[model samples]
Target chain A: MLAEREEQLEALLVEREVEQFLYYEAELLDNRELHEWFDHVADDINYRMPRRLMRENTASVFSERGYYFNEDYGSLKARVERFDSEYAWAERPPTRTRRYVTNVRVTRDDEALAEDELFVEANLLVYLSRGDSEKHTFFSARREDVLRRRGDTFEIADREIRLDQTVLSTDNISIFL
Target chain B: MAAGDKPSVTEQALQDARDSLDEGFFPLEFFHDENLHDLEMERIFGQAWVFIGHESEIPEPGDYARRYIGDDAFIFVRDESGEVNLLFDSCRHRGAQVCRAEQGNTSHFRCPYHGWTYKNDGDAAGIPQKSKAFKNLDREEYGLAHVPRLETYEGLVFASLAEEGPSFEEWLGDFKWYFDVHMKLPEGGMEVIGEPHRWVIDANWKTIADNFNGDSYHTAWAHGSVLDLELGGEETVGHAGTGDSLDRHIHCDGHTTSMRGFEDEDVFLTYPEGVVEDLFTKEDLSDAQWKLARQALSFTGAIFPNFGFLHFGDTTDDPEKDVAPFFTIRKWRPLGPDKMELWSWGLAPKNAPEEFKERMYKMYTSNFGPTGNFEQDDVPIWKGITESANGQFASSQNLQLNYQMGLEWMSEMELDDEWLGPGFAYSENLEEGGMRLFHEQWYEMLAGNDRTDATGTPMNVQEDQ
Candidate 1:
């Protein structure tokens, strides 16, 4: 009974660490520290956001071979570096965004994941205000991530963002989800 | 125009538009006027041939996808006999829509409200309780209605609402010569890679029409970030009339295409050597078309009233990756005076290897779609324009936007006398004649006149050498 209790305490500590890492990442993105955030990405990251599709009867259906973003490490870096250019007018004024990350769940026993890697799922809600108008928009999504442990910290090794909206209402998806 | 024989726009406004267009000017208020949008819907979209889905989108006999023309929803389906049909989605009984999903394959569509069923070919197959309740109703007359006219060219489908007007060939005219290079260059021809990327933005459809109708001058300044990241080469996205590359803007039969290329090199749009050597063939293309394809680095074109395409090379998702080509076709459906839905599709040679096709699609998304590096900036600018024109100051002041960059009075624009194609080609890409042509056609259609009436030889071209 004492040993089982010790295992439960260990799991709680791991969950706390995972939650802290996710909050820190959100803070980095909200502050627009793109380079610093990119530094947290693993060298061999596979980042993808497939296009969500709407159909009858089936509740969850994404495009078979279509995506808004399917990026490797090199391409993801290029996207991060692009904002540094003075001509990246989409973000010229910069968008004001607040990210709310909730419902963090971490899995360690999945056989598909390596020993050092953890599967994490979380709900994300981003409130975005752009231009000089009072009008704003929100992006709600569920993110599935593979976090590779490095000492006390973690690196995002793989991420798949499942957005809720089939038809986007924003002028453009200029900001990273 | 929908309310009666009289157009929603006044005759005086149309006359002003004609005069302004002749002087290379377009009024700003036309971009966001309620009455004008009504006239545009009734006249321009109602009479003109609007682009539908590509043939590859529905390859199977029972395959179907939901589509739209203006605000009308349609079911673009393929029947058992392999015939494609654009059937109105509304039911014949209570006018409730029968197709519920965005896309699917089924032998029949049954309305959820009243249980009226339709075959894949749009014929009424069954009606629940028909024999008992409505014994006199004939199923033959109750089939879903089809659009007035539908035509296909090289797997691209277009539909026209007018019952009688110019045939599709007459509408396309000699512009097919230029489009042939895009469609027929490959041995088995091109096919759409995946479902289109669609986004609704607060910008008038005309804004995109003007841009695609040969606004080459905006490339360098508007998309400078793509160039800065080295995702696109300077020759492919550089300042107009400044590059050593051979640039020409061609206006043919109300359609426009602008090209950038080398003088005598075999660019083949910088396609990988393996795909080019295996898939490209001269058997289907003429010698002149083959030369154009061989030398082309990029092609940006538009088919009026709202179809646009871009076939470009020397671009990569990452600066470290090898440059590959991307082909994208798009349409802007006007949702309102200040709104439009943009549908864009990436395509590649049908016979090309799957890996190359995937790469081509990646290049397209990186450069041109809603999430594209180049496109994200363009939407906000166009949206700002629509906002600027919404206030009373625009109409009260008669604000006229300048489209006279290449007018004879503004600049000495020269025509390419040795042009191989059927259109009048401007030797320099700095010209704005293509936009002028688009406005003239827009004006003529709004004035209840034939669109071809606006196709007189442009002023600079008509002048003596």
Candidate 2:
């Protein structure tokens, strides 16, 4: 009985650690510290956001051939660095965003993950306002991530963002989800 | 502003617009005027040959996808006999939508409201009540209405709402000569990659039309991030009139295409050796068309009213990756004066290797889509222009947005006497004549005249004479 109680406490601590890391990452993105956020990305990160499909019978169907983003480390880095140019007018004024990360779940026993890696799923809601107007929008998505333990913290090794809207309502997806 | 001399609000606005166009300018207020939007829907879109979808989207029998043309919904379907049809989405019974899904395969569409069933080819198959309730009703006369005119060219489908207008052939005219180079270059032709990328934005449709109509001047400044990151070479994304590349803006049959190529070189739009040697054929093209394809590096063009395309080479998503080519076509659908839906599709040669086709699609999303590195900056700027034109300041000040970059007084632009295609080619890319051409067509259509009334001999030719 004591040994089982100890296992439960260890799991709780690990979940808390993961929740803190996610909150910190959200703070970095909200602050627009892209370079700093990039520091937490693993060298072999595979980031993707597949396009959603609406059907009569199925509630959730993603297109096998269509996607909004499929980025390797090099390309994602290029996208991150692009905002530094003054001519990148999409973010010249900088979009203000608030990220609400919730419903975090961590799987430590998945056979597909290594001993040092954890599979995490979370619900994300990002509220964005741009161009000094009352105009605002929200991006609600479900994110599946692979987080690798790197010394004291964690790094995002893989992430798949499934956006909820099939037809985006924003002028452009200038900000990362 | 005299009351006796006053025209209706619309007539006055159109008159001001015409005066501005004659002076190589366009009024800023027309971008978001509600009255003008209504007239545009009644005039331009109602009569124009609007792009619907490519044929490949529904290749199998019973395949169908929902499509739109100026707020009208349609089911682009292929029937059991392998014939394609565009049927109105509304049910004949009570005007309820019969197609529930965005895309699917179905032998027949049964309306949920009253169980009115339509065959994939739009023939009314059955009524639930049948002879018991309404024996006098003729099912033959109740099939869903098709668009007034539906036509296809090289697998690309277009539709017109008006029963009377220029035939599709007459509408395209000499522009087909230029488009043929794109559609006929590869063996087995090009096919759309997947579903199109769709996004709604707050912008006027004309804003993007002007950009696609050869606004080469904006490439260096607006997309500088792509240059700064070395994702694209300078020649493909460089300052106009600065590189040694042969740059020409060609206008034909009320359409425009801007090209960048090397002189007498086998660039072939920088397609890799495998594609160039195996897939490209000279069988369907003339010597001149083959030569144009051989020397081309990039091509951007637009059909009148709403369609645009970009076929580019020497670009990559990552600087470390080898450059590849991407071809994309798009249409801007007007929702309101300040809102439009942008639908864009990526395409590749149908016979190319599977891996290469996937890579081409990757390049397209990385460069041109809603999340593209180059296009992310373009949408917001267009939205801002629409916003600026929404207020009273522009119309009150009589603001005239200048399109005079290539006019006689602005620059001594000349025509290319040795052009090999079926259009008037400007020798230099530093010109805004294409935008002026687009505006002239827009004005002609809105004025209840044939759009071709704006087409004539090139002004540079007249100037030279």
Candidate 3:
């Protein structure tokens, strides 16, 4: 954000901002406070995870646009309803998972659209443990975030999560990556 | 054939099964045995008409993708003439795989090991050096084996393993009307979004089919949150008798379709007030929404024997909020007696507006597939069934699936309900009749029995007998 924050916020390090965002988000998810996680998003946020294909170099595997996950704010809200409902059996026992977001990186291609738009690139490593079983392990290609500032705070305007595995080994994706 | 493959359905078993159907209901053992699943792979999926892809998948002459009918793999490609052809995946040379990738665009498919290439038309095109490899290798005789017969019904492509199974249209019969109305004949036929979202679970393919056709039972309690956002208050419709089940069921011709009325009794409410005219034509927009829901009108299209395409989702929030309806077609591929690989996809009219398409896509991702919010809970129920089948008493349980709603029990309601099928009752009690019908059809289809026999008295119903 080029407008520059008030003097109280200090000359914050890009590394520090990225790390802070990653950790805070992880804390919210780990604590199972999905509502707080939503607060991190801009009012009209967009999140996408286009499916990745495994193939030889220079060749595309599949580009079914709707192949990966795509979600808007209302749909995301509806998604959260699953956990909010007492009868949703998937979350009934309440899955215990932790998102270990790591490998933060800022590339030269980083660009800022406007005073409010901040585009940053980061690498993420998540370690997920569901109900004490070594069932699922996190392996996402990289996360690209397009954060926008509203008033005094940064919130997600857009996010694209990519997974390394073409096929998910776990049964259901009740929790976010 | 192995001794075990020999016909096990002796006069007694066949007579017993045929006899059981006389009164009503076949033995549960027909569904419980390994032989049944194996026979189905070899017979039904192996011979009957099975869908492979939408014509849209390979719009270009060189575009091609891999698919399967049961375990037999095939490749679908649009040839130079702009016609789609389905062929076995094997290469004519050395029997190596011609197209190794799941899907891609290429002028010619070449086998990796021996460098043999074939055209999209399923013909042998090249060798290391045609003249060098051998004095004479007939290219015409070495082309990729085109599937016995391939047909297209309303942009949906189907490949029949059996050369003589009922003609494609003959097979689909009256069901084609349903597909035509909802899927085909639409202003613009639908197209798949991406590589299918796939995940394996421990459950019968039947469980998944039944879930799609009428498991509204779980919606109230299981998908309470999804229902809450779309159908708040008593309008919540899918809760299928969990003390909250809705009043509906339509059954006919080995298929079951269900509709639920939630708070949004009129489904048209989901659309932007001004946009309805633009999205649906005057004919398509027939006061269909006002008849039932805030965003009503949902169908569970189950064409029996495990190939099920059903809309098991709801409409999203406000237009300013931008939420569209998400529809899904789930193929619960039976990996085993209790194992299934859910192959799912999201479909949208190719003619839909960009914004509407985005809305539809978002709604779909937010709810179905492995990462879908609403569908995530379904796996647990599937797993729960898989787990229960392990118990001694559980193993003996026969699952006592219900299907009591019949002409006798459901006729009265059909009289009162507008959503009932030509011959089905929306009663939850009349559930498992579908499962029995499927197993029965499965047995007949796989046994190499007659396919042209007289169908039952139902409308356009055709099955092996």
Candidate 4:
């Protein structure tokens, strides 16, 4: 006999549902559908990338002055606009990128967060193949996001990226990580 | 290709720079030459008060951050007693880089090369093979070699390679008012908000400095094409940034200074005359608020060396950082002659109301940093300038930036009493004059009380200040 609970936390936030959203977001970003991608974030979302520093093994760069990018939603849109325009020469040729966001952690019952806040962290790997450079270089980081859920949709209110690279070799951070 | 034939650009370029003491701006050659680049790093970058890192970066007792001055790597950290220290990020024992990463909180930094250890204060705490490496090495004396001097004002960290000079306060001089107004206004001094958005641009560090110091002229052309904003297009920022005009001034020891107001008919001339009267359809602001907004005046200037701050309120709040319009402090650290790593921060109004802080950060992030709204457009231009100036013809890259706005102070308006503040007054039009004033200080610091060459032909006009 199967007993159905009134509201099971697991069912409310199933792994398939969360992973589906994650993968879909990544595809939209990779494809440069910026407006569609922004729909997934909360209006007051905070996006930040703490710098990754070179330090002793026991120290975590996440805690120090290590930051790469810290921005909000409007700033994120402006960045996309730069790439979207011919004026944004950094990506005028439009550098293609593949983003992989893994290890999505869903904290449904986190007491520390506000009612609207949904916590998730994703480990991302970005591979960019630009111009004639044959040797490939990659970037990886762990993202801590405080996603806000409004009714049926979702938004990002705060996000922080902890990068693993002390010395960034990327041509430009025109793309959102 | 011969010195006498067409003349090697290297010789001709140096000759022109030596001869053209009147113009403060130099040729692109100074930025790209490998030998001169090396000398700049050793002398200018090495000896000057190179901005290291912000003090807020190392808030905790064991917090630390890494920085780059030219190719050099230095670390800034907070000790147990909470004092900021700058040290070469190298292990003294074996020369392995101690702080190999950008920043982190650490009780002790142990080198991976050979397990050498150092306390947060840069003291040699231990060595794995202590009794084996040598007979004896004093750990205290052998710890990290600190930058010559570590100093902080308004929460920004600055280090000088020279052990002696005017105090950072004195060197900063009257510029303290600028810093005090913006930086000191913030409650906890100011937090970096996040890591600095860093990128290697392909432009001379000096050019970038000149550009930011008060080249409002480019805003209309460069960012205008990019943002579609009608900044003073033909005019640079100093004399012609439409919203306002600045009378360029300089402090003793070479700090380029200014006084600004909204007078240029060139400004807002782009807008239909009396456009506000047409805004009768839009009825939100009271008459007083609207008048004040129109009356708002601003100041943008730089300290003699590389430290400069920009204060303008084109927009009251940045929608991105959720911070209000603010004063910004930025230092162009020369990574190379033609390469610069720009460190920028937003200074909120120290006395601003709470909601104002939020608006300032948004404006700052959207427009300024690695991912700034307007910033995204600027980096590519810097790179383009550096790339175009790299070849043989690169030597002849004549950026004959002019500086003859007000040739003599006697003819210029007095800066005091009649000026907006207590500063010198020169025409807002001669924008490059500030760059000349800056370089005059640069020469003074670099050559140390002399500009005469072997032929006694003065290398620079000593009167720029």
Candidate 5:
């Protein structure tokens, strides 16, 4: 009974730490603090959001053919640097966005190659407002992520975002989701 | 402006806009005017040979993809007989779309609204409760309506809704040779990577189309971030200073192609090592054509109405990396006077190594795709132009936007003595000659009499002479 109690406590602690990391990441994105957010990502991070297609039920919808974003750490850094330029007209006025990350589910890898790794899945809804309009573009996606423990925190190692819309209704994907 | 208070666009207003083209001006009213937009739907898009999907998209016998010719929905499908067909998406029964999915491999399409079915070849297959529905219905007459004139040039499919107009070759003219450089890579030829990247933007189709028709002048200022990021190198900044690149615009029959000759003739755009040799000896192209293709660092152009393409070389952020060539095709599908749907596709040579293909796709995504650095900057400006053009203060029919950069130097800047390609080649790449040709063609299509035969020559040719 004492060992069972200890196991329960460990599970709760892991969940709490994962939740806190996610919340902190959300805060960084929401504030458009991309440079700081970059620090929380692992050097070998692979971030990708493939193009979604409307296919028949029997056909696979996840295409390996194209992507909205397929970035490694180096490319992502270049993309982030573009935001600082005055000629980046899309974000010149800056888009005000709020990332609402919810339904965070974390599972410790049982067949783990390393004890410091965890698998995570979360639902993300980003609300973006730009120019002189009250109309906001809502972008929702299911994110599958792999987080690696670092010192006292966690760094995103891989992120594959599956967008809900087949045809994105937004004018441009200027904000990182 | 109040509701219902918008000024009606008259034929005379359109004529005035057309006439203004010669004076290096275009009326702002043409940008977002509703009546002009509606007229363009019937006049330009309807009559012109609008590009659909490429043949590579539906390589299999039963493969089909949904596409658009103007605002009209279409299904580009391959039949059992190995023939490609462009069918109107509307069902014969209730006029509902038969193929709702963007793309799929299907032998038949069944409408959900009503159970009317169509074969991949566009023949009506069956209808639910056929015996009970209509005993006298003629099945032969119920097949999907085929686009009157459909043609393919190097796998690029184009369809004209009109029963008659100029031949596809005539419409393409000398642009065909330049287009070949984009499609025909020596070995296996180019194939689209996947389904196109699509998004809607609040901008006029013509505005974006014209931009692709040799509007290099906007690059240094509008896309300065590209140069600042070092993606375009010092040569790009040089163009901004001396406008030396402005001489590359080649004005053909209602089309414009821009090709900047590199001093290093061996500097082929992004092919892997040894690929250039194979490309040079490719049996498909003539020796002269191969020589011309060898000198180009990049080629970009718009094919009249709305089809635009780019075949250019680019490098990653690492300066040590070699420059790689990538190809992309885009169509500015008009949604409304102030709105358009941008459909863009990335393509690579079919025989390229898997790793090289991946790199080519990445290069395309980073530069020109919807989320691309260049595209992200362009969309906002296009939207800004649309918004500004529609405002009350700018609504004056007399308001003209300048198109006068190279007007004074047209005669002196001609490159006829040195250039080898067809078309009137300019001495610089940053000139407005292509834009002028595009507008002249647009005006002719809008103002000329509608052709009753498919063989009728384009009106711009007659007007030019």
Candidate 6:
């Protein structure tokens, strides 16, 4: 009974902490605090978003062959560095963005992996407005993340963002989803 | 001007547009005119040998992928007989697309709207409730419509809708040698990594085509951030320099190839030494071609209407790593007058090591992919150009864009005798020769004067010369 009570408390704690961490991460991205957000990523992070195809029901819809971003931490940092440069014309006059992260679901990984590692899945709808138009571009994705507990905080070790659109309607995917 | 004939305003406008090209200027209206877009769909894309897909994409029999020729959808499939077929997506019964998926391995396609089915080779296989619907519905007559001409060169497939045109070979002309240099890999040649990264940009297809054909001048300013990153080798950086003799641009027919040779013979350093040696010995590349390829750092160009390619060597941010070679093939699909869909594919040597392929792909994505620093700058600028062109002041046919760069110097700069590939080779990479050639061909096609025979040679090739 004592072990059962501890298990129940741990589930509650995981729910609370993971949800808060997601919200905090979303806040950082929307607030354009990319450097601070980078701190939330593990050094060996494997962030990737492969191209999605509309295939026959018999065929799998995801392709392992291509990706919009198959980035390691160093490459990700390099991309961020470009955003800060004066010559990054795409974002010179930065666009206003908002990320609405929802449907946070967290589950502990197999015991063989680690006690602190968890698999997290969430839905994201990012709205961006650039230039002088009231029009906004909406990017929706189902994100699968591997989060590992590090001290009091969680760091994303792996993230696979499965985007909803096959042919992205936006002019360019300059912002992360 | 003729008996009982009054030309429409569009025809007059098109003629005026053509005349303006000879004067070193093109009307801004040409970029965003709805009438011209519709005309181009028929005159240029309809007649020209537009790129469909690489042969590697559908290697095995029954493997198929849905592709587009301008706005018309088609199925690019490898048939049971080991021949590539470009079939219109429509079903004969109700005009519904027979193949809905982007790509798959299927022996046949069954239309969802009406259960009409077509074999991979475009033969009509079945019609649902055939006995009840019609008494004598001929299956052979109802087969999917195949493109008039389908051809391949070194694994790159192209199709034409028009009944008559120059053979694909004649259309390629000197560009074939250059294409081979980019495609002739060591073992199995090049293959598409996956489904292309597609996105729509609010710009005319011509705008993007012209940029890719030869717009080295913009690299210094528009891609200043990329230059600042210094991810490319010295040759690429030097090509961006404001020097007259840094690179070369070659124009043939409607095709253009702009290249900047490496500072030293180390251009082959982009590839693994083993791979280079194997390709040089085994591939069908000529001695001159192999020599030029060894010294080349970048090669980018367009094939007539909209197909464009870029093969360049770039280094990673890791200081210890050597420069890696990367290739990208793209099609600027015209969605409308002021909008186009950019379909881009990343390719790598089929026989390269897994690690090398990964590095090449990474290098490609980091620099030229949809989210890459370079493309991020290009798409926005293209959008801006189209937006400005649509404005009241710029929309007027009177305002002209200057295509006058290098027009005066072109006469003085003799063709590079040392370059044995083909076409008119100018020493300077930043020249507008490619753009001029593109517009010249664009005018000929639109004017209905450039028709090709079975050999793919333009009917008026001798006359035009």
Better of 2 and 5 by lDDT: 2
Candidate 5 residue lDDT tens string, B376-446:
88887888778777755566546788887666534234354466666766666646767777777777677
Write model 2 residue lDDT over A40-144, tens digit each, in one string: 999999999998988778999999988989899998998899889888889989999999999999999999998999999999999999997998999999999
TM-score of 6: 0.92
Q: For all candidates, state DockQ relative to the true structure.
A: 0.75, 0.83, 0.41, 0.22, 0.68, 0.66
Candidate 3 docking quality: incorrect, acceptable, medium or high: acceptable
Ranking according to lDDT, highest score first? 2, 1, 6, 5, 3, 4
In model 1, the runs with Cα more than 4 Å from the true position are: B1-9
Which 10-residue window in model 4 chain B sums to the lowest lDDT? B450-459
DockQ of 4: 0.22
Q: Report the C-alpha lDDT of model 3 over B292-355, residue by residue, as the tens digit.
A: 3334445555765556664533455322354446666767667766677777777776777766
Against the correct fold, how does model 3 do in TM-score? Answer: 0.81
Residue B119 error for model 6, in Å? 1.4
TM-scores of the candidates are: 0.97, 0.97, 0.81, 0.71, 0.94, 0.92
Which candidate achieves the best lDDT against the true structure?
2
Tell me the spans in candidate 5 whose CA falls farther than 4 Å from its real position. Answer: A58-60, A110-113, B1-5, B131-133, B236-247, B279-282, B317-320, B409-412, B450-465
Report the CAPRI category for model 1: medium
Task: List where candidate 2 sits over 4 angstroms from the true fold.
Answer: B1-9
Candidates 1 and 4 compared: the better one by lDDT is 1
lDDT (Cα, tens digit) per residue for candidate 6, span B294-335:
777778888888899888875564333566777889898998
Score each candidate by Cα lDDT.
0.90, 0.90, 0.62, 0.58, 0.78, 0.78
Of candidate 3 chain B, the 10-residue stretch with the lowest lDDT total is B456-465
lDDT of residue A5 for candidate 3: 63
Please write out the lDDT profile of model 1 over residues B1-465, one tens digit for every residue: 244222234668778677867678898888887788888999999999999999999999999989888988999999999999999999998999999888889899999898999999999999888989989998999999998999999999999989989999999999999998999988899999878888888999999999999999999998998889999999999899887898999999999999999988999899988988998998888999999999999999999999999999999989999999999999999999999999999999999999999999999988888788889889988998998877777777878999998888888788889988888999899989999999999989988899999776886667654
